[model samples]
Target chain A: MKLLTLNFLTCAIKTCKTNSASFPLHPRDAELEIVEADVNLPFLKNILPRLMWDELRGICTELGLPELPATPPTPADLIQPSSSTPETTDAAPIAEADEEPSQTAKDLHRVLLETCIQEGKLVCGACEHEYAVKEGVANFLLPGHLV
Target chain B: MPNPSTPAQTYETNHVHTVYEEIASHFSSTRYKPWPIVQTFLQTQPQGSIGADIGCGNGKYLRDKSQVWMVGCDRSTNLAKIASKNEPHSVIVADTLALPHPNGVFDFAICIAVIHHLSTAARRVEAVKCVLDLLRRPCSSSSSSTSIFTSSATPSGPGGGGGDDEGGKALIYVWALEQKDSRRGWDEGHEQDVMVPWVLKQKKEKQEKGRRKKGGDEEVGAEETKQEGDKTFLRYYHLYRKGELESDIEQAGGVVLESGYEKDNWWAIARLR
Candidate 1:
């Protein structure tokens, strides 16, 4: 499962739904793999504001990846500054298409879309219930008792 | 055989989940065509909108929109494995009533042809509530993040978003009881609970070998022998009567925005009330 998915997932237990600690399930002994995918800059920009930055940063830190910037990047920060001349400013309609993705966008895409957990267990902080991830598919099916 | 007294989960595990697991590949091969109503719903979501496909068998709808991010979940692990292959979308093994998603966060959700498998009325209503709970709650203040997308101007269809404050919408589909014109010919008075059989034919090579082992003289009992090689699994379904789906949504604290019958199934698009 991608780290992006972890943002939305919580402990499946009904009782844990009210617990603040259930959201952002923590990864344990995760075997990470990079599965390359084309970067969709517009999508990254659109999803940027919705991302829970602090939780994602904590997850990255837990996984021992490099620390992210203290704050989330704005949509403008994700795009490279247009290098076109003043003559091209008149072609405003097509200018948006010409805007290139910056290095931050690529890194963001790499973390959110490309990096996948091949095998691991996501431990719910509230109940300490572990959901196993195998072959990049996280099993969120709770046992009968948990359900 | 599960009786009326059997637990809904246990009954579904035997009659629904197991059947799908055993026939995942064959079932997925036959279910690639997206229904027009469902196709339109997925296509109209704003770019980069996040959604969930509950009980997404083989993830056919997941491929409908590349601009939106969708995460699919299924009770059957085999089906989830098949659905996980859809790029840019993830699939996890999860029960509908116990979905792992946090409450009130998704932009949209679709539970296509899945709710009918729950053997009880309460469980079915719970399933609808579960889908609604995944949606973003209605916001009184117009947040900048949501207002930034001007794509809402796209032509609104039957269940498309028309109001900004009405949270996320969920499209749910189920087999209708009033499908007299369909191949099954089931109508209003027919038994709503029925076991539908899926026959998986034995491979020709296997059949041929079995015949050869029986030594060509067993013609009298050939039909019985052939039946032995072929497997038939019965899956349980509770066909929805007209207005039942809408009622369930209402009972689950959802408001049905639009509903219609399509190709023997009743579907309704709903948002949390």
Candidate 2:
């Protein structure tokens, strides 16, 4: 599963819906793989406001990845500065496609989209129920009793 | 026939889940075409909006739009495996009643040709509630003020006034019980709960060679022959009547924003009340 999906997923158990600790499922013994994908600049910009930055940073830390900045990146930070004009200009043309993705955008894409959990167990902190991930698909179907 | 006292889950397990697992590949091959209503709903979402596809068989709708992100989930492991191949999106094995998504966070959702599989009326309504619960709740100020007017007005188009400020909406479709002109000829008075047969043809050497030479369409034509080796699987369905979907939505604490019949199916766009 992509790390980005973990942002919205929680424990499937009915009782865990209201539990705070179940929101960010902790990845344990994860086998990470980088499946390269083209970075979607607009998606990154639009999704910026919705991302739970602290929770995402915590997941990255748990996976032993590089630390992220405390604050989330702004939409403007995702775009590269205009190469034609080296100096700041008071009036800039409103051309969105002309702008290139900055390094920040690429790194964000790498962590959220490219990074995959090839194999692992996502443990819910509240109930300690573990959902297994194998071959990139997380099995969230709880047993009959648990449901 | 299953005993009347059997639980809905167990009945569905035998009649629905197991059959899909066995026929997943053949079923996916036949389901490549996206229904027009479903296609339009997916196309209208704003870019970067996140959504879920509950009971997303073969993940055909996932291919409709690239701008919006959608995560699909299915009960069958085999179908989920096939659906996971849709890039930039994810698929997980999950039951409709027990979705793993956080409540009221998604921008939109689409459940097509799925809820009809639930064997009972109560389970069907619960399934609708589960999908609605995944959507982001409307802003308090706008919802209370605008809901009265919107409900009284004519049915809006996809994403009409119900976008961002109003809240996330889910477009749900189910097999309708009023298709007398169709091949099956089921009408309003026909049995609602019935087992639909899906015949799987066993590949014989002679037929395989013929299929390769002729084309894909030849296999569908050959279905009429009823070869001895062909295995038929019976899947359960609860066809919905007119206005039934709207009633279920209301019972589930959802407001039906818009609804109409499309190609022998009843579809409605709804949001949590």
Candidate 3:
């Protein structure tokens, strides 16, 4: 699992739904890997608003990776087509140079898209439930009593 | 494994899991492509929508659509591993009866070719309700307006103010025992709950292959050896009759928005009210 996905998950216990601590499960003994993916800027731009930046940063810190900024960049800054270039400012029908993504956008892309946890355990804060991650798939099946 | 004294349901669950694990690789290869009907259902969703695929073997449906955040889960760990290889960080090993997600978290969901695996009527009903439970209501702030309003039948409200304008919607598909040319004419007393066999092809060892003489002699020998090594694995299936799927969903508190037969399978798009 990627650190980005963990941000959206909470303890599956019924009562844990309302407990704030149930979320943002702390990563323990995490083994991470980096795989190259075709960065879809449009997709990243679309999902930015839904991500909880603080939760993402917290997990990144636990995994010993680069931290996300306190404030994520505005969706417009990421989505706006680079129509105005430094060369012409408003050039006519000429081939334009590819615009480089901002430093913040690159950092977000690395943490959210490039990195994945190969094996680990997600420890719940409220009930202290431990979910194991193996072969990149988290086993979330709780005991029959918990269910 | 369940003892003989245990309920038949427990034994059935064990049978399904064991068979899937044994044939995970071959099963995944056979299911290389998603059904076209399922692809159309996915295309209807807006970009950036959070979607879940319950019992998502091989994650075949989690392809090409770059805009949707698709999460996949399955009871089989081996199949989940193959799926996660393609979609790292998005697959989970989970049971459909007790999914790991919180209520009303997913904007949309799909459970294809899954419900029929349950061996009993009550188990099928439980599986259907579990899928419905994962869906977020249509009126939830995150849902797309186009999805709900497009349906012709507007379900009555659980909310006083015209009810909650939205309930969760899902597409469910089940295998049909006697649809089209799928089966030979059935006798009067055909069983609904049946054990279907999956035949696994076995590879012969070098010594065995070399022992065979050359020419047509080898051909006859190979045919006989093939029969000896063929392993047939049995899986429990409760094939849905026509109208049975829709009835199950409605019985589970889902409002049937639309339902019909597609290809050899029966499917329905329902709103959980």
* A21-96 per-residue lDDT for model 1 (tens digits): 9978999999999999988877787778678889999999999887878898887788877677456555634444
Question: Per-prediction DockQ, in order?
Answer: 0.51, 0.46, 0.32
Put down candidate 3 lDDT per residue, B86-205, tens digits, no spaces.
Answer: 653388887787676766666678999888888778878888887887776656455321233223221110112233556657899997766545333332246677777666556546
Give the runs in model 2 whose Cα sits over 4 Å from its true position: A86-92, B1-6, B140-164, B204-225
* lDDT per residue as tens, model 1, B155-268: 111123345567888999999999897657899999999998776556644544554554323121123333556887788999999999999999999999999998789999
The model with the greatest DockQ is: 1
- The residue-level lDDT of candidate 1 at B25 comes to 73
lDDT of 1 at A143: 67
Please rank every candidate by DockQ, starting with the best.
Answer: 1, 2, 3
Give lDDT: candidate 1, residue B179: 86
Model 1 chain B: lowest-lDDT 10 consecutive positions: B216-225
RMSD of each: 6.7, 5.8, 7.8
- Misplaced by over 4 Å in model 3 are A79-100, A143-147, B1-9, B141-168, B184-189, B204-226
TM-score, ranked from best to worst: 1, 2, 3
